[model samples]
Target: MLLVAPGPFALARTFVFRRYLTLRSHVVRPVAAPPVVDAARKARKLLKKRAKEERLRNFFGWCEGCGAYGSIF
Candidate 1:
């Protein structure tokens, strides 16, 4: 059996490759939504939630005492 160590160029290439991988992994990516976009998203979410509650209220009945929808099924 024969063993050979990596040459200087091979070591440098490996170092650069490892450094590139580290830099790529440590990159900070900002995921920020604009205020207007955030507000619109919240509004859409609220509307969807309200629509779901309304559907449930209509399918069941609004209990005036408990202030919740009555489940018939």
Candidate 2:
């Protein structure tokens, strides 16, 4: 087999390519969520949770002593 060693420019190019590959593989990009968007998401989640709790309370009634929803009688 003929072994031809890479020249300086070829070595540099290989190094740059390897670096690019490494960066591409290792870099983790987070999903972009601005503060306003994040706040709106949190508000929506809170509203949904509150609505669920209200529904459950209406159906099962709230237990004062146990501080939980009462059992279905």
Candidate 3:
């Protein structure tokens, strides 16, 4: 119905002739992930892993700086 017709006849040709970019046919960007995003993602993962490791280590012993198990519980 409405989807088959354009708002104006002039626009129909423009729409038909336009080089539409689909998911697979997109103009290639410089890089999908920028250097900063790649670095940040890596840093975030590393920090998360380190935090888990630190928590495990503190559980086994204790962190004097954080005072995780000194007394307050």
Residue 51 local lDDT, model 2 = 100
lDDT of each model, Cα atoms only? 0.79, 0.79, 0.72
Ranking of candidates on TM-score, top first = 2, 1, 3
Candidate 1 per-residue lDDT over residues 1-73, each given as its tens digit: 8899878699789989999998887676554669978998999999999999999887666445345544533
lDDT digits (tens) for residues 11-68 of candidate 2: 7899899999988876765555699789989999999999999998876654453455
Please give the TM-score that candidate 2 achieves against the real structure: 0.39
Error of 1 at 2 (Å): 53
What TM-score would candidate 1 get against the native?
0.39
Q: Which residue pairs collide in model 3, if any?
A: none
Residue 31, candidate 1: Cα error in Å is 13
Overall local distance difference test of candidate 2:
0.79
Candidate 2, residue 55: the lDDT equals 92
Candidate 1, residue 14: lDDT: 93
